[model samples]
Target: MTYYWFAQSVGVLAFMVGITMFFNRSDRRFKQQLSAYSAIIGVHFLMMGAAPAGMSALLNSLRTLISLRTRNHWIMVIFIVLTLVLGLSRAHHWVELLPVGATVVSTWALFRTSGLTTRCIMWCSTCCWVFHNIWLGSIGGSLIEGSFLIMNGFNIIRFRRLQLRGIDPFEVEKKIVKKMEENQAAE
Candidate 1:
């Protein structure tokens, strides 16, 4: 097989992992898994000679890791600056900017926001990635992003339904806290 085919096949595997993780209910778990698998996707982008996409994915991994550790906006600002610098440095075509814009949206969503806002921003990012994938001829990658968008929309609808019933869709995190309290009481 050709090199592009091999590299895209690997990218497809990473895309599947990343998409699965993206759907995780736990925010921390989702970010951790996304960071890990996205590194592989970045390498795949590099192998495919899509430098802008590769850099964006790498920076996205870094952003996820940092956001996981803390919610400090300063750190996020620094990363945004870095992303802008790097993106502008190598960006020759307008299409190359697509991944960079997606990264920016994702960084803000993961770091500076929460609740429905985060989910909304993620959907926007998914749209950008879909465009990027199509530009790069990554059929699997585009489909993965499309799937992510649909799943996110479904989850949002489910959350809205829970709200209509006076339930917080985010109660899972609270459940975790409650379980910890129960364990403490037992001890």
Candidate 2:
């Protein structure tokens, strides 16, 4: 097999794990798991010589991990700025901006939103990633992004149903916040 096929094979495995963790819809663990797997995906992209996708994935992995710890938007803002600056530093075609766009949207969704809102924004980001993957000739990446789009759509619909039934699909976040407050007060 060619080098491209070999790199993409491993990339696909990482993408599967990352995407699966993404849709868990449970708690911060989702992002944490995604962060780990995404680093591997980044390496895969690097092996394929897709610098734009590789850097974006690596940055996104960092973004998810940082977002999990703090709600501060400064980190995301810095990340976005770095994305624009460093991302453009290399001689790249405009098509390379696809990953940057997806990362920006995903940063906002993961850091600034919750529940249904997060899922909605993530769907949009996933669409961008799908296009990026296709453009990069990553067959596995495209397939995983397509599956993520479908799965995220289902989740949004499910969350909406829960909302209609008077349930907060993001109750976990609220609980976490409450617990944090309690801990801070005790301290």
Cα RMSD, each candidate: 4.9, 2.5
Q: Model 1, residue 28: displacement in angstroms?
A: 0.9
* Residues 47-143, model 2: lDDT tens digits: 8777877888898889888877665667879888876665666527777787778887888787777667877887898888888778888867777
State the RMSD for candidate 1: 4.9
Residue-wise C-alpha lDDT for candidate 1, range 96-172, written one tens digit per residue? 89888888878878876665567778888888888888888876677677788888888777777777899876677
Total clashes for model 2: 0
Q: Quote the lDDT for 87 in model 1.
A: 80
Clashing pairs in 2: none
Alpha-carbon lDDT, every model: 0.78, 0.77
Candidate 1: regions farther than 4 A off? 172-187
Best by TM-score: 2
